[model samples]
Target: MTILGFSPGEWFLLVQHELLLFAAFFFLIGAIDELAVDFSWLWLKATGRAGAPPLDSAITQKDRLSGDAAILIPTWEEEQVIEQTVSHMLKVWPQRELRIYVGCYPNDPATMSAAMAAAAGDTRVRIVIHDKQGPTTKADCLNRLYRALCEDESRQGRSAQIVVLHDAEDLVDPAALPLLDEALHCADFVQLPVVPLPQSGSHWIAGHYCEEFAESHGKAMVVRDAVGAALPAAGVGCAIARPILRDLAKTNANAAPFDADALTEDYELGLKVAEMGGQSRFLRLRDGDGRLIATRSYFPATLDAAVRQKTRWLHGIAFQGWEHMGWGTTTGDAWMRLRDRRGPIGALLLAIAYLLLALAGLTFTLEFVGVLPAIELSGGLKLLLWINLAMLLWRAAWRFGFTRSIYGWKQGVMAVLRIPVANIIAIMAARRAITAYLRSFAGVVPTWDKTAHDRHPSSFPSALDAELRFAPLEAKR
Candidate 1:
């Protein structure tokens, strides 16, 4: 079949060549962008400016902490994990100056009850029920908690030095709060590395998070901090100075600082702090025992859940983020903003690459049977492909190394194997994000797309055993 004076074989060759050139051009650009980040990270590491010194676990962090800290946990329907999370946190951190404020809706009795049960008459745990019915944005819930903290300050005649944000499903590291407190002495906003615990039931679907966060938190965040770019909060394991929060609220006419309409309020909060001239730091620390002082959590285990969670992220960070934040004036901020907004574009490229792979396979089969003529690759295209391949190998090696450092050599190997899985998920999530973003034009109000959680790290025997082993070393007072 011929059309427009071209035979079917010629048309196939033309289509393949165009697709290759298109994908190759964008991929090469993306490769260079990634290489820039890699070099920045290497420079920071080589200069001995990457992270803080490891803390001495023998010396209790609670006593060393600079000042009182208020932890704000937001919830909509997190009853299943709230009790375990709160209980474990209280048991692990036994700091007298720490207060946990749990934000719950008036209608979510189950979650409020679970939070109260976890409190068990502990004065540190304050369950603040939102006056609204249910299912408002997480940021809105967080604002209510912030207001409660302010009122508590008025009642107690004292204020918390730091305001830490967390989700109801997070597994708070005992050492994390102290580290944040210490870091707040220098930084207005501090983000701790987030390590996603491997799910026993769903390795590929959930384990991909392990690979992504390992490299992101381990290397990219270090680079961001070194280069003076704003650090985006992982939400669960980040802290902001109470003074900064108060200042932010003042900027918004003395209302609670959080943007109630934002899909990813935590992310915006960090950037907002930086935009307001507040110093932001990403703290990657370890205890003397060699355990990473970071928040660990179980991400979505099922493919549907993972896709949904990621879709919300891409929609918020890539779509709404661009609309809200825009590109700032500084070069570092602009570059970082471009990197943050690359998710959807990267996913598009991945999809095109997959399509080209299938097309290559079909072309090879046809050419072997003499049904189609072989097409010679262009010299420039060949060079571009070679460069991209080199970058891809470098990326894989780093992924393996980072994953191995966090998990083990076995999981590192799995990280390489799971690359395709991660790519596929990104593609699906980006597609859904585009649809969702477009639907917003029709006046579709964006609501929280909460990821469901069932398994908690406390449920694991090893986590329990570790807590028991460290009980003696906790706050001695």
Candidate 2:
């Protein structure tokens, strides 16, 4: 607590070093596991022994069945893209077998109007309005959609085999339907890769999403699938088995499969399904044309918007997840959960590391001018610092490889350069997540912290978006 003959700046770095080393130990454990997964997958792919699910039934089947599944979209103040989102789904999904259930609130007439307009006489689109007022939570809205799906099943005397989840800004892949149909044969929960479109304007804010997701979907998720853990839903590009959805709903007191109070209900659902002995999968499959079938969309473009969205994600992952989902019995599950819930602590470490770097700079300047004694590091501390630095470089290299594979070399290199930016965002997001979590715990009442959306860029010339725009109209006519 007290040190003699040490200047204030020296004291700062000395204390910072201890904190950094403490946090680094935990980070090191995670990095080791992550690297193991990455290396294992590389070996598997090299040997051509990747975990490819069987395709016997799916390949032989000729027609994609519509009644086998339904797509669920929840909207609140999504007037900007609700119609297009619905129309795009209608355009891409199998018309005969798939039914879409869009959830809305009675108070938000604009979104309802947009959703209906997009539906535009298509019998496949069913709009389910929540009984409550607007913007309760995304999970609350999904609960409404689940109830509506049940009612529809009763009305039509038919049951859907799968229920797909998506958001209002998605550009769904037409080829994805058959894959989902095939995946559901053996999986109770299926999650696909999310590919975030580039933002020409917000390179530091929105474009960071591309880098983060590139690493997560490409490497981290592959590890999860390989390890056979419950796959966390990206909240988009995921499908749930209808019977399992009903089972989850029945267990809940309100009969809502999604937890209204959970900030990240989609994520919670994955763990719940896993607890029930269900199979959850995250797969990367290609179409016949060799294109990766993925869900495409844009993340929030502004700094504030990006922070707000990440704040929600960290809150759900670190705070809410701990309170809801208990640490699992297995070693792998505990390790994975520790990785999930380390956000706030990890941000604290990064903040300390940055502060020490700043102090190191100031110390060097002052000592060079003979205003302060030169700061010296012990031999043992120097070795520890060297190890930590090496670890950091390894982490950065892994991220770069994953990002480069997805976004090409330029973005990949930039992603490595953007490590500092990602750290800063994590620090800001963790602070915000803690504030929001404390407020909710203090009985502030958790409501939906809505993230604003932007339509997919028209100038980018997406054949899929163009088809979503015109094909549904033609089909309706």
Candidate 3:
């Protein structure tokens, strides 16, 4: 029918169809988000009722020292923070039982020098230069270190029961190593929550990091454990059992334990572990002072760093999800596969939604100016708007309740308001990442997008007051 001659019913039908499709897409995204939130809530409730479990109770003291632990930090041009990272490790961990591996590239003389200086007078810290012949990613460096460790096993004669990955800027909590060792006794892999160091340059970046960590490591991971679903490992603060590492090495020899080709090796490793039928757990480590140990790790303190980091992550997650659709095939469950795909696909949909919203606004304006025909809003349209608004309110309330403190409440409110813009940026980042991945799939390797850290150094106090006012008080020492 011609636009001007179309009957009212026909116009309504077309508008209704468009609205219905949009509503369906919105509802799907909301449902997945809410499900994740609900799972987190249930986990928090259960843990509260059960009381805080003893960190050390998870493993025996004998097991802690029975096998050696390797702390691997992958560094690339991070000379400034490398020393601090190593110093913090030595301060917190007992050097006798734990060996540290600092992976560096031969070209990075400054970082190599700093690493050498950090290792001086400490035999436990070993430096490995990645002088390999090809394209390098963090995963490639990790694989090289793993091979080196395997090769020197005869001389060291250490079992290397647990392998932990930390970034160069991480000021690891003193109790983290012990807690990880304990957690690993029962689970094949363990992940610890990382709180970004507060920086003044951009509150958004810090807030984003905080909210992401809180939900994923704090609440969502607990939920994952309760439901027996596999948990994705955060790149830093993750530990793997020696046997699992060996198996991973054996299975993906050519690629490396952390795939150099993959954008995010940590996440890919987590998926691989799930595929291998190994269980992974996350531990929220608290120190002797009855306070949650918040490590001082640099966030993107500058716009350039923020963009680079986000872009890299966006590309990595999308690439792996799209290219290796059957990585988590052991489960073979249709629902699980869909859930796994949600991260990348959801990101893509979010981006599309923004573009559609803009188009709709422009169309409405044209209709008002007599350039386009007006479309009637039908019952479906009304229902869809109402549903979307309700979901938004529910999510906001859930976040507020979970983060109940005054500062937390303020941050939560601000984050809710910024959701639209933040999501738009995320979508753009994801698209760029996907494009790069497609190119890589066709044999074009992307270089490492190294995020610059804050040069203005800060220190993490060796002692935090035993009482943390914001979070629940920890058990007395």
Specify the highest-TM-score model's number.
1
Ranking by TM-score: 1, 2, 3
lDDT scores of the candidates, listed in order: 0.86, 0.78, 0.66
Candidate that scores best on lDDT: 1
What candidate 1 gets wrong by more than 4 Å, as runs, is 56-59, 464-477
Candidate 2: lDDT over CA atoms? Answer: 0.78
* Weakest lDDT window of 10 consecutive positions for candidate 1: 468-477
Total clashes in model 1, counting residue pairs 3 or more apart in sequence or in different chains: 0
Question: What's each prediction's TM-score?
Answer: 0.94, 0.91, 0.84
Local accuracy of candidate 1 as per-residue lDDT tens digits, 23-123: 99999899889899988887887888765467866544556456778999999888899999999989888888889999999888999999999999999
Which digits, one per residue and each the tens of the lDDT, describe model 2 over residues 140-180? 88888888888888998989999999988887876677777
- Weakest lDDT window of 10 consecutive positions for candidate 2: 468-477
Enumerate residue pairs that collide in model 3. Answer: none
Model 3 residue runs over 4 Å out of place are 1-20, 36-40, 47-64, 133-135, 293-296, 325-337, 356-374, 403-407, 456-467, 471-477
Better candidate number, 2 or 3, judged by TM-score = 2
